[model samples]
Target chain A: MARVNNWQLGREMSYWYPEERPNKQFAAVFDINKCIACQTCTLACKTTWTSGKGQEYMLWNNVETKPYGFYPLSWDLKLLEMLDGQEWSEDGGRYEGRTIFESAPAGERVLGWRPEDEDYSYPNVGEDDCAGQVDGGASIQMPHMAWFYYLARICNHCTYPACLSACPRGSIYKRPEDGIVLVDQGRCRGYQECVRGCPYKKVFYNAMTGTSEKCIGCFPKIEQGLQPQCFVNCIGKIRLAGWISKPGEERPDNPIDYLVRIKKIALPLFPQFGLEPNVYYIPPIHVPTSFTRQMFGPGVDAAIEAYKAAGAEGDDDLTGLLGLFGSTEEVLARWKRSGDTITGYNDKGEEAVSVPLREPVSIRPSYDKLYQITRVNCP
Target chain B: MKKTIPKIVLLAFAILVAYASCGGRTVSLSEVVVVPDQQITLDPTDGAWYAHPYHPAKLILQDMVEPRLLEPSTVEVEVTAMTDGKQIAFRLEWVDDSQNDLPGPQAFIDGCAIQLPTEESVSIPAPQMGEEHKAVDIAFWRADWQAIVDGRADEITSIYPNATVDHYPFDAESLKKDPDAKRRMEQRYAPARRLGNNRSGPRKVPVEDLRAEGPGTLSPAKTVSTGKGVRTEKGWSVVISRPVPGFLSKEKSSNIAFAIWQGANRETGARKMRTGWIPLVIRGAENE
Candidate 1:
């Protein structure tokens, strides 16, 4: 077994400090093997959150088909160009990865140095821009190798979010209580600093209000001990919301522990980019390792292997917890052992767990009931 | 061999350079024509209105007046003659109300010469003849004035300032007497008419009954407490025992005025205006 490095552990713990920071630190672990890409979660979030003017161009949560897939037309490529240095040729042509800044004449300078420079780089390819259907090659001879998968993504609410550091107006802030990063609309001048600063480009400018807005992480509902609208409405049952252990705190031996820790299927998205995104994903099962390494990072193989080993150990609790949408023996035992106190170490010192602090409670009924209460006008 | 090669290359280069320089062509600059600014003047025959294009002025009208006469009264027509051999024509029409065309006795004056060279004055007498008044609508147009009337050339805005219509009351009786006479006169004098208003007084009409009773009741009278502690025979009570003017009542104008004016008037020899001309008469003898 490869030794787990301190950088990865330290990076993970930074998210959990100052209160097991809620949605910002707590990531949603997606079992991509089970995700049918029905787009239920995407639609659910769209109707609840992004159904406002100026939000028309935004998809706070989106399930994009992979390979040739991107929401704002090559958003990843445009961002990569900004992040990686590019240089101008002697003949005044530009090529990527050549120089930090392009050489120009005294009066002329190449534009678009920062991420915000490519604000609309994500091309929202409308239906009009779609290529018409066409057949390629002989049907039998044409390779069936092109496989597309769905990736549901949102603000990772990162540990050291680039957006927070980039804001000059000091409008974007992470709550000390829950670590939820929020844009103060009153203070924001719409300089689009946060939008450019955020490597993920999650902060979107609302043209109607003339201010910046982002995911609020459903803080009001979370305060009532309820999951976020996105997680609660996830039809695939692929999203789980719970507090992570505080730094130095031993993780619980429950199903959440198995799903998040032991199985190791839940890996952080684009860890190589070093954002330490809170949202994690169970790597898509059959994609080639080379593609995964390029997309995710070098640790993809080991993470998958650890998950497989955990399953083979005849740990039904581990297996069941790792399975799709069913409570495993471990989950049941944890539920039965409720109120049984156990001592655990937090960052400061050891503390007794009077009850399972963070467990996956039934989010559907509460969400439906809350919907009914808040949506009194609904038929 | 090398020396010969260099000579051959130089000879080819010289031939290419000679062909390239000789192939270049020249372009001559076109003649620039500077057109002098045209001066347009609409001087009303009655001298009631004057409009000069060189010094444009605006007339403001309010909606309270009659809508027919509220329109623009007059516009002058002028254009600089261009030597491009192109004839110029000018036409003015009311933008809003197309049915009201400007009456005309349009004139083509030499703009270079401020005075009308041929005629001292061109009169477009009000549309109505002498007595029974009818409303007159008038505007001006100039073209190769001959071609415009002949319909040979289209009316162009560049040659004409914006079209304006002036409505004025005309004598209806005169129009009736010369039914065919009016048409003949219009045709005869149509070229010299200029459209504009002659009136210079305020045009707003005052509105009566500006305040109308709406759905709700009027505000109720406030019950003000006096400080004298007096209970009237009527159920209304006053608690004046505290102070003459309570804190809440200090802001009232009547209370503040009474306090200031209640003192004796030294200028009037202590004679109180409120006590009337004399003191109350007694029931005893008048002179005792």
Candidate 2:
């Protein structure tokens, strides 16, 4: 029998006990289908917070078109190629599980590829090289069918953030109270240790101050009884911000509930990395289930079913899903209750949800005092 | 006959001797002029002496003589000149608290010249040897420029009675790098670090005050008019103020994407900055 590592279990799990938890575990849920990729949120955030010097290269918020999308130039594919390896499965899929090879035969790998390789390549439309030509009535070279969806992303403020673990200096910490992750500006030495460790690569160094900065989750506004600026400012009304449960509470019968728990439109981004990211997404309905499962997790089917069942009996359309799960109160309640297990009942009276709770974790942010010099005239 | 001649000669010689003695030159030896060494004594009772108006002369001496020895051969001397003129120089040599030779006090002249002044009263150069004596005579020198100005060099010289050399001993290497000395100089002369006139701390001026036509600068009635091109939740509708002219062309649009973020409390009417960006693409207009 495998030895039960209760300590390890304790190290990995976190729960939202309504009476004990500090502020609800607030999160923003986004439906990929509704996102128009306008980048208004990026500009809004840029003008508000990141317009300062040292933040020139920073996008605390960004939206990238997927299938061939990434910032820092192909960051995702490059990291993926590095972590996994050259062999495609004989079964015609890009990956089987997660096996990374040390080295492969010359033809087996895409040779001479690098992360910095695309600095001069124009892969995306409207980029530097292709800008005015689009307006000059140029013929379309790429078909529209190859177009992919865009995902606007920021710090998820994860339940088990890999960024927190990668910091050797203990500068990264999460608030046990609100579950917001932050880097202590004073303690951070701009080591880039956390940057290398985080699978998401959200931690960034500010060139001006020589320290790492990341999303603060809009905690100050949240504390003042307001939703996050990102959630509140979503022009598409596609983002919802509220609390989630510790996996064992009563579930709601709303659209958000259907998307998160029932229909599972809103599923965790990548659970196998095991960081347990809090920001969930509603699976793109047009995508294949295999791809969806790979993007979300093994449990995408159950979540989708839960979403379909939340609406009135006769409705089968997307609007019904939106109508049933869109309300904040029911969705928030269901999230608060769904901790270690799914919190709603089904017609069969069996366990209807699978919300996994493993261990409790915390992140504490710190600050440094800096001196400024000013000139004065004597009297 | 011989006896009679001898008697006549003796009588003549005796008469000549008596005449010479009676007419002797009446000379008296010049009264032996004794200056009595000009009995110089430093008037300890003087107000100036008690007030220490004159800089104290410090003698830095090296202890070459052992106490157990009957007599020591050599002593190294370092003299620090502290007085601001008005003082003279003198050296008193003695052996075992006994005076051997005392040089008369000399006044400093000619702008405290480095070379010793050679007069009946002369100022000796620093580190000069005293009158040689056995049993190692200790010497004391006074080169007070101030005493020389006061014409009290005679009195200042008397302070040393059976004088013993005093040394200002220190590690030359350590003094060269004295941290405390550096700190003292810095404290006395360096400038202090301070913030602005409002030294309490850095003041954060409101963001609106920093920008022209911002919230703080606008009148309440004009608030709605100032934020025109910029989108706010309540006063605006989603309009393509500027459209990408040929968005559908093969060439990429300079503005290929449009992103939106909603303001919090859009209904109740609070003007706050948006938090996050959600990307949107332009599909052909519904009318088109």
Residue A54 CA displacement from its true place in model 2, Å: 0.9
At residue B237, what lDDT does model 2 achieve?
16
Query: What are the TM-scores, per candidate, against the unseen true structure?
Result: 0.41, 0.40
Residues A197-216 of candidate 2 have per-residue lDDT tens digits of: 45565666543333567877
List candidate 1 segments past 4 Å from native: A1-6, A9-24, A81-145, A254-262, A309-313, A323-379, B1-288
Model 2 RMSD in angstroms:
39.8
- Candidate 2 off by > 4 Å: A1-23, A84-147, A253-258, A300-379, B1-288
How high is the CA lDDT of each candidate model?
0.36, 0.37
lDDT for A300 (candidate 2): 54
Query: What TM-score quantifies how close candidate 2 is to the native fold?
Result: 0.40
State each model's C-alpha RMSD to the native. 33.8, 39.8
lDDT of 1 by residue, B88-170 (tens): 11111111111111111111111000001011112211111101121111111111222223332222222233522231112
- Give DockQ per model, in order: 0.01, 0.01
When summed lDDT is taken over every stretch of 10 residues in candidate 1 chain A, the lowest stretch is: A327-336
